[model samples]
Target: MKKVPFIAVEGPIGVGKSSLAREIANYYQYRLLNEIVEENPFLGNFYKDIDGWSFQTEMFFLCNRYKQLEDIEKYHLNKNEPVVADYHIFKNQIFAERTLQSKQYEKYKQIYYILTANMPEPNLIIYLKAGLNTLLERISLRGRDIEKNIDPAYLLQLTKDYEQFMGKFINDHPNVPVLTFECDHIDFIKNKADLEAIFSKIDDQLFINN
Candidate 1:
């Protein structure tokens, strides 16, 4: 198989997207780009009151991700190396739609579209989905203080929103493959079999499509 230049793994919080991205980046020696979750000042407050802090949190992520991608394009493109990232730029719109009110969402969408218009798209996007129970357990195990107050209902809504977002994303960009993995039963972190299975599927998808 011809080497893939870039891959992005995406999922709702606690779905293990970063962990899988790490495994893939390590295996392929690709540059790993994990999203910055703790750096946002509004994140903890957003968890407490989403509506109040959503815009600030979203804008922080938008600006940071834009800068990060710009730097990656410059440095990695020059070196001709591959990149494996935990989050895709599209998440900006997804989370914005969920967190922002109608007026805020419209404004946010305008800014988002502008920022991402010229950004490089990932060759393949691996979206991992898991049941709410699985998400809750994983979130608990990770034990982020800000995440401690996260409501189960909110996570359930996020799961549905992500599914909706992925569906539209695939429909709009048919050329880029979006491999959906249902990860309720498997522990990709601990089980080598599960990790291998995910990578094998990624390999098959890329090879078949390419």
Candidate 2:
């Protein structure tokens, strides 16, 4: 039997994960699953003082993402409907490990594993990445008020964390294909050629090669 495609776009902040995911969903007519970000009440405070609000912020995201995946599993994946998500649930661990202290992270890890044990993993992961300056510029252009107070240092470190995590992810999930794009050179939003290039690669990965 042919498997339904579940594609997740992942990256550090302002790396164009959501935008690319939306484009992919539109092109393929798949269900779009976007991660809730600005809706979190703790987000603003979390940016202002990451240390003070890390636990609350991370917990809220983890719970919400878990619920989102539950719905996807029941209503979409089980029904054999394809889906394209802006963020992968594993990203929670990336942010949590970066922000939370050792004890808090240990506890968070326990909850994370239990909640995600039965979750459906993406068949393909589209990893977007950019230089720190490019990331900062894109973030500023979007001008989300919640992200106004984000520290450059924090964003820089998050990029590194993503790189390391993705390396291990590829090793751990060899069956799941990952297609990475460096966004510093391509502007998918503004250039039709760039967008088409991405779409072509996605097709090759999910359809032709598969």
Best by lDDT: 2
Summarize candidate 2's per-residue lDDT along 87-185 as a digit string, tens digits: 999999999999999999999999999999979999999999999999999999999999999999999999999999999999999989999999999
Q: Output the worst ten-in-a-row residue range by lDDT, candidate 1.
A: 201-210
Q: Give stretches of model 1 more than 4 Å off.
A: 1-4, 206-210
Candidate 1 C-alpha error for residue 158, in Å? 0.6
Clashing pairs in 2: none
TM-score of 1: 0.95
Model 2 CA deviation exceeding 4 Å by range: 208-210
- TM-scores vs. true structure, each candidate: 0.95, 0.98
Residue 128 lDDT in model 1? 95
Evaluate residue 84 in candidate 1 and report its C-alpha lDDT on the 0 to 100 scale: 90
C-alpha lDDT score of every prediction, in listed order: 0.88, 0.95
